[model samples]
Target chain A: MSDTTPAVEAGRLDTEALEQVLAAPAARFRHDYLEVRGLRVEFDGFVAVDGVDLTVTQGDLRFLIGPNGAGKTTVVDALTGLVAAAGSAQFGGVDLLGRPSHRIARSGVGRTFQTASVFDELTVLQNLDIAAGARRGPLTLLRRRRSVPPEVEAALETVGLAHVRDLPAGVLAHGQKQWLEIGMLLVQDARLLLLDEPVAGMSQAEREETGLLLQRIGEQRTVVVVEHDMEFLRAFASSVTVLHQGKVLAEGTVAQVQADPRVVEVYLGTGAHGRGSRTAATSTEVE
Target chain B: MSAARPGSARTAVARPDWWRREGVRLWGGIALAVVLLVGVAPAVLSDFRLNLLAKFLCLAMVAVGIGLAWGRGGMLVLGQGVFFGLGGYLMAMHMKLSDAGPGGVPDFMLLYGDGVVPGWWEPLRSPVVTVLAILLLPAGLAAVLGLAVFRRRVRGAYFAILSQALAAAFAILLVGQQKVTGGTNGLNGFRSFFGYDLADPVNKRMLYYIAAGVLVVMVVVVRLLMRSRYGELLVAVRDQENRVRFLGYDPAVVKVVAYAVAAAFAAVGGALFAPVAGIISPADVGVVPSIALLVGVAIGGRATLLGPVLGSIAVSWAETSLSEQFPSFWTYFQGALFIGVVAFLPNGLASLGGALRRRRARGSAVPEVGPASDVRPAAGSAGGVPADPPAGAPDVTTDTVDTAGRHA
Candidate 1:
């Protein structure tokens, strides 16, 4: 776990260095930034995600921490075009709100489910190969893959699953499956990654490795992780957004949000509202 | 496990030993099939039996498409009969036109209609257009339909129902157009096929060879597809469509390609069926025939490359033999066989060898302790099976369990 410290520090420094060096194209970078405004999602009469505004730039290891039903996942869903969203989400100069999910993915956005959804019947290498084949034409897809691409090989090494590359993903351990899903995102060259509870069921060692992996990746890409584990968030998050009941409750560095009075109140309260019971249930589940 | 290390080595340079062995097994399996289909069956069987075998080969062609679509892509395509019928009708029309001579109307039109061919049937007089239409029309229609349905994320039983309805509607449409489609009787008595006399046994043998040759080519094509990157993507789309979508692929497009390919294969099968069976009718391309095709695929092992082909041939042979002996029992027996395969062997008969091997491993070896034991058998037996079985039979079993649990 301590070894992750140097990588995290280096990641921070690299981000600052990139900020200064790429400042000339700062305007261009801002155009490609993920900027969401007044995003709302409704399921029947129930508002799952209320008017939320978020701005995630490159090199952002942004953590979205909230209690259950706080609409953290819903916000991610809206951005990924999984749900119908109102208002505007501009990513890479394209409005992501009404576009289909695949189109959003085509515009360099990728996501992973909490349960680590992977092609279980396919081997790990094949999974990565398929992910790397997004821009491949019909003819290329039809032809047999004569060689494993360098990017996929690199991803396998980075994810520490090179030994099991030939095994079907179905047989992968839970932690390895989550890592494989992340590896898939890497091979896709996704500019924006929205990971939902990636370390939910991982062991401590796996969680530490994941934090280091996220830090390493967050150096160049924008990543928003919807998380429940407070310790993991503290270890890796550069900045945090706290949501309560479909609205943004607070936003700042982990220390800053931890210090925020309203955030503390939400975390501790067992008030008259139904949120008390829900928060209590969820908080008990969070280690 | 000794071979496992090399199999895990980088695919480009190391060229895993398992891969080489798999190639040998694949081509070897095809070679065996070619021998049986082209050489042995024709040589051994009588002329009538050879013709019957030719018809079975035509039907097996449809199964190849089904294997790609339903087996690999996880689409329950229940309307292949529509495409099969399209091909059969197209070929039949061409044959009828040829028999009537250039620019002359078919004899059926003279008898059933007002002695004039409809303009739609006129283009089929040109062999070139007929052939092209036989190949392209069904595929085009399937692509269009696939785009419409898959884009909207319709799948599972709903897709099956929609496809089945298409077959029903097509049959109804043909029945209603009595003058054009020859009512329920449909078109029959194709005396010639591409200038070859159908009555001549030599020409019939040539037709059998043609069907046999086409079936082999199709199997090889499907085998290539199953080994390609597209095959991996198709399986991925089947198991986790939403996940594939996030990987920057339109799952709908992946699905459409497979669906269209399946349609094309079924169409070709139907095209060959017309001349071989000496008829094209609604009965041959309706809800029942479509289900029959599916049953054969299910029984043979839809996922395995040759499973569908073998299953189709076996089922057709059984139908011919059993129906002759006991007509009423064959249908019930087919239903029972489908149920038995789905219940006892969800991966189809192709997976039976793998299953038996696994059982023997479990029984002979010390009782396997945990999840660690699960992967060893799969890795060790990579080139062991002749069907080139897909990975993880246990995974599919669990998938079935999940589906059942969800419904329950």
Candidate 2:
């Protein structure tokens, strides 16, 4: 009976400790807001996302950097509920397993896809209006009854797109469209935002602006950003998680992760010729 | 959800609110036109023309359904003919049975060598049963079909194909069931509707007025539905289905409701069509005729409120007049017209007025506002940012670079 009592006490103590850990603010160096345990995604026996564990804590702008077939997007898909996932994904004590993407969205997680999904025909204001979830009924008969709240305008302003609000979303610049998408995420009031390659093809200036925008957005919310650009990661992300062959090879500050032998072996090994040139260019730019 | 931030305030823009001010004016104009045409035509036109107009009104009822389901909901419902056929067949059967006298088979059935009416047709002999069936049957079928298809998440081209196939199958089934359904000939040759003598000119005119009144009521009902929350959800589902789902709306259920309403409207139209047209045949309930109905809607601009009704009437009128004048080449001419409209005017004839108005306004030297370039600097940045590349530029390569940079 004494032995059983200690075991029960130990179980209770462990649960209390777990709860405390979940509730406690994440370390400044680690921004993991959500943690996945043994996530296994299969497509007819082809294991696209094999038993993988990932942690995305708050305040940590961690990069899920990997090669082409490394399942970074699949991990994002699983987290967003776009793809069915196996095992538990614990976020703020809620188990995000077997829930629909919309339910997941309502549960304080917002996501942007690799491709833009804005309505092409609708105006920029209309796009934002639709995303705002203000219009309640089918037709716009009562739409005029309730005016567009100031908050919606602020979101568009935040994205630096106030001037062309009346223009169709289709006419906006590519960078502006991405920003508009981010604005949509902002309107959703999600605690966590998942960005999939937000800066894939912008100019250096655009990329810098994006980096600044991400850093600003990250101050108020947890942002999980995936990218292939090491320079951008170094500039924006506080921490980095290197993925190779569907598993985390290393996770630390940009310099620390860059120095890790395994990360170098996997990321830099195949591109031996361009490594020195790129490194020199990066060092010169920093200086 | 985070606390509401004050930074999210939007600047109000001053634009001519067309959907509000101009929309009312346009609707008012339409109302005036209806008053002048429908209200005054009865006083001026012959009874025969008035009755023909009433039949057209019945067809307009079917158009209302097409507009709601296909235009707004984006459901390409080619099986509306099935509902229309159900209503017409039910009404025709009732009228035929009423004219046959108690315990007697209909005149056509007796002449066609049917000694006894089929058991399936027996229930329709009662006006109550027939009327109930007319309304309930089409809606019931639509509900069942909608449930099956929508539950499976079948949409787009697959949904269109499935609905068109249903129309074809319905027509074939009716044609095959000669003894029970009157086969390819269909139920027709009614002598009376609800104890009114069909031979009397006054009665025919009365039927026309009834159809016109019913059409007006249907339009009002559809307008109400379009203005309701359900209508907003329907359009939302059409535009951003995933987003609507995320907003906690089951788009399937919304689509089904819209589809069922459309089926009910079609059924009512079919019921009136039987009495007014004096015939309901396989030709009216088949795939070709179903496509013809859709053509009218597409020609008029399916999404526009009055497009379907006006388009259907116009097309029907053209077919009647052209066939009277040039029967052999009228079908070819109609096909050419449809092709030209689809190819050249994708938005349809309803948009023509808007386009013409815009052109005329432009011709009168109305200065158009160049694109606005007064974007405020991004929050936390005092420096004005340069204009970025347009989002939906044809150049995919540029987008790839922008996306890469933004994510990086």
Candidate 3:
């Protein structure tokens, strides 16, 4: 998980991936911080996200949790340039506001949709290849792919999709598809990952696996998860930001957020408290 | 077991399996086509039939471009006639000027207007300038048009209609400028082509060979583009435009490149059509011919490399043979064929092989992801289901379930 880890297999001394990483210093692991100040998004006359401010630095596995229509996704959308917002979202010394989505992505910020949007017609390897090809020149893109980049190969192994590397993405299982999307971000060299409901339709076991995968990925970058599943957040979140009615309600550790009165009121008073599964513990009361 | 997989990645990379299979097939198909067009057709068919075949090859050139733009890039180009007409008219103008000799006015100008060649027509007096204009004009126009349209996010049927409207407008413009464009009569009656006597059978055969060579080269170029990383990106944009953007790609740029390439190909086809068909007119470069070009591509299978070319030639041949006896029925038949292909076989005739293989695999209880035909998803599956839908109702979740089941 650290930057010093060898890019290739442990015993392999020289490989294409190792050589590639060595030749390209920019490919080395580097952390990027995301700073949002007074972020607001309006759909016509209705404000979807209003005056939300947050900061996520290196190794912060911060969770953005809120009830339905509480503007959890709208904040991520504002940061990723999916929606026109009036605020400053600074990432890696570049302002994400007023820029196109692809330009925002080029500035080391990547995001995944609630529904995984991997190309269904391409193979798993081809999906990663496209993500890895952002820096390639036009003439280079015209030539046939002679070899797989080390980062793509590593991402394949990380997502547990090396076995199905050549299979068309459409035939992948639901959990596998989500992992493929994350793996794509990995090869894309995204420093800030804003995942929106990554495990929305996953089974219990798949949820745990995705949580562990996020922890491993968060070790060298800034990670933000927008989740409605409180149980999953409580289990894996190092810190949490609670959004209520288009604004940040609370920001702290899992226990601290649970103890905050304003977050409890927003979750319960909004009549959306019993929307998800609740355990016997009082911490589950947030659900 | 671990050791066994160590070099597997390298093995996969070095094998070039796709190139070995599809590449070999492509080259072999081209060689066979060259043999038939160069050797067999000339020996067996009469000069008149050979000329008609050459004309179809020129039309097939436009289909090649459509295969790239509509088939791979999902642009739904319904205005290729504009590019075709641009190339054809440019070449026709050059031939007319050469026949009139330097400074002498063409017969059309003498008959229709004051005896003076238009300033625009003067530049094409040089064969070099004419060739360059034929090559660049259509592509340049397409590039500008594509950038403006795609950047504003105009696509789907809106893009199609815009292209069709351009074709319609182009035909009207030609008609309005009768003094220059030859109006309804169009441009014809050339005694020679590039200094060779058109009246000579030897020169006519030479033109056929030239058209055949150009078509073969076009197929090769398209094949190379299709196999490159750009090809994958083009299809990626087609299927998921938003996803490609999030991956740090400008979908507009990708679309513009494909559209411009298609335009260039159509232009080349048009230039050839003028010499082979011996005419360049508003009727040939209009809305109906544009649709006719698409019908061939749709029937051939837009997604495949050779599908459009072969399908184009087949459809043109079919029209030549069937339309002569039942001229009225040909239009209805073409329409019906296009409708059936879009409805039942959205991937066109090329996907028939894949569908048959899928069925046989299902029967044998084997999951076969056949590499032979690397066909993308059904073109119809890009957005809507294209079949039956409950009117004005939201079937979002239901549709999701249905698609997931089908994929499984």
The per-candidate count of clashes, in order, stands at 0, 45, 0
> Could you report the DockQ of all the candidates, in the order they appear?
0.71, 0.13, 0.63
Tell me how far the alpha carbon of residue B304 in candidate 3 is from the true structure, in angstroms, after superposition. 0.5
Error of 3 at B274 (Å): 0.7
Chain B of candidate 3 achieves a TM-score of 0.84
Clashing residue pairs in candidate 1 are none
| Per-residue lDDT over B1-408 for candidate 2, one digit per residue giving the tens place of the 0 to 100 score | 012211211110243323235566557645865685568878987987777777777878888899999888989887788888888888988888888877778876776646688778789778888878888888888888898898677999999889889899989998887776778888888899989999899888888778877777777677767655456557767877766554434567778888988898889999999989899988888888888888888888788777888888888888887888888877898798889888877767887766554444343222223332321222112223345443212122222332332232
Q: RMSD for each model, in Å, please?
A: 9.0, 14.5, 11.4
Docking class of 3: medium
Q: Which sections of candidate 1 miss by over 4 Å?
A: A1-32, A268-287, B1-20, B367-408
lDDT of 1 by residue, B139-248 (tens): 99999999999999999999999999999999998888878888788889899999999999999999999998899999999889989999899999999999999888
Better of 1 and 3 by DockQ: 1
Output the lDDT of residue A272, model 3.
Answer: 33
Q: After superposition, how far is residue B326 of candidate 2 from its true place, in Å?
A: 1.6
lDDT of 2 by residue, A33-83 (tens): 688888888889888777778776676676777776678888888887778
Residue B4 lDDT in model 2? 23
